[model samples]
Target: MTASGDGEPRPFLVAASLSGAADADWARAAAPHVDAAVLGGVALDPVSRAAARDLVARGRSEFLPDDPICWIDRGFAALADAPVRPGVNVRSATLEPVREAAAVCADRDAVCEVNAHCRQPELRAVGCGESLLREPDRLADYVAAAAETGATTSVKVRAEVPGVDLVAVADAVAEAGAEWFHVDAMDSERVVAEVTGDTAQPRADLTVIANNGVRGRRTLAEYAAHGADAVSVGRPTERPAELARVAEAVRAWREGELPAGEPPDRSEASP
Candidate 1:
């Protein structure tokens, strides 16, 4: 839903980057505390699914045996009546599965997030996750493919990748038609402002959501000051206490009750 008079989707606290094990029940549990939830980093196509299987064999948890498309549909179906906005984070070595999953998400009015943040060796080897970061044009192609389905498209990315310029990556995806830029600002919090700030001229308007270490008011306020449209909790997604704290913090920030540190000098904030 609209969070302000600007017609932008409300800045929300989300349960972020949960694994395939996250299902309807998990979404339901997180719904009480989060405005939105991203489920699955599920492998979508056969090649990626094979890679996922290899990962599972090496002790990774994934949505296996169940078809990726079906899994996404089932997850959304279960959340049909829930108050929380639903999103599916998907992984695939090919464009087809990305398009297919985005179609399901489109029909359900949910966000279709492309997983560009996973650093797993198996996933990276198959050209799925962080591998996409190094190939910005390819990543843009994936984002464009997902956007074609009429679903709200998001790309989950992380900072600190050697040789990768996140601002450039953000620009590429936004130009490719992504609506959401989900940043896992690992220790580099100010990068949120770098991407969200108005300095990037001719850049498509993007809803920036900062992820990582978002526990309560302080962290939430910190990202806000950095120009994040929202904040999300990653590792603590299952902890009710943590989730509640973040949810409340988000509410306070949205209502202008929390102090987001000094505004950056707009003149110096540039990509």
Candidate 2:
């Protein structure tokens, strides 16, 4: 139910993106409950791979293997028959790997998501992840490189970063040809509205997906009220019941069964 009978995007969607755990098998298992699934968050290139290894040494979650291009190809190959829209969330310090990965995504008609949401010290120290938030021009360059490959490009960002203006970052990436803007709203769900509701220069073509603390009907309603085009589940993505609940809530909201003013509830929010 990710799209209409004519193959257009659905009114609302349940998306899931796993850091180190996402693979073809995970995507297949979760595909039944989600409309779209982003895989990997894989580290591409020498610098990013080195950063991933450091994170691994520190017991942080990250996808491994030195050959990330082959990994992206193989992962997408295994998901050729999957029902959900497949995407790869990637980390790279330079444009070469991003172009390489986005080329692979273009070949498969998949999404190439730039990782600007990771806040780990190791990732930031290497100019990957959240470090891009502080350098919007660099982040936009990554998005532009990905877009140049003819793949659907997305940028995953976070709010409440000390000196970063999330809306300006959104505009920069959007101007660089990003089709999707995935916002990890953290504790500021209203930021979704701000990004989507930018009246100065509306980004009508950018699809804004709200993440963090999204669980069931309550959170879903809250995000929708804040103008999020869709919602994504992160840490709780492996829980089938939780995915099912969120999917059901999406369906309810689409069908007008979920109230717009449903009280905010963070009891079941994911980390």
Candidate 3:
């Protein structure tokens, strides 16, 4: 989805995982409903493995296809389980090990997002992913490097940053040829209430994707109503059947229909 300078409609990202084999299936099921997809993995690929071996100091964790690398195999395994073709909410971003990993996505015309939002400390000590969010210049540099690959580069980042305004940081990343702005919003009742009426400026600009604590149709609709372009979730819709239900709910929200009430009582769909 293209965004005008003043902000545009929200977009979607089928946030899935490398470890959760269900993500691929969920992605396939959710794809038709959303705008794009991001295959979230918590580890490093082989090349990243070598990079970590070289660059990381002692005790640094290797951020691979997943933070644990075990996630990579799981993610690929999930891809194997998909019945319908994978689709998603907004733009798609997959974990890459080297330029070649990016090339694979580019060759297939698949969108790959850089995982800069994960906050696991193992990744932080090594100076990758979420840790880099604090360094916009580094984040920008990473985006620039990813951009050079001829593959569309987008970043998944958290809402709060220590040094930069989350919104401003998102704006800067978007300005640097980054196509999608993935925002992981926590489930705060008061915050949730304000989202729908919070539209000001650039907030609407670009594709603003809301993530984090979305549980069921009601919560999904709440964010959509509040101006979310699309929403990427994990627990509530990780299976095909569940994804279908969630997708229908998302469609309902988009069309002006609201789910009966607030979202279901799901305290587990945490970040």
The 0-to-1 C-alpha lDDT of every candidate, in the order given, reads: 0.82, 0.84, 0.51
Question: Which lDDT tens digits does candidate 2 get at residues 1-271?
Answer: 3443223355456455677888888888888777777888999988888888988998877789668889888988998998987889999989888999999999988889999998988889999999999999999999999999999888999899999999899999988989888999978888999998865543667888888887888888888899887788876678878888888988887776766786878786765
Q: What TM-scores do the predictions have? A: 0.91, 0.94, 0.65
Top-scoring candidate (TM-score): 2
Give the winner by lDDT: 2
Model 1 clash pairs are: none
Weakest ten-residue segment in model 2 by summed lDDT: 1-10
**Cα lDDT tens digits for candidate 3, 139-180:** 666555555676565567765546746655665565555655
Runs in model 1 deviating more than 4 A are: 1-9, 199-204, 262-271
Candidate 2 collision pairs = none
Report RMSD for candidate 2: 2.3
Q: Which of the predicted structures, 2 or 3, would earn the higher lDDT when compared with the native?
A: 2
- Candidate 1: minimum summed lDDT over ten consecutive residues — where? 262-271
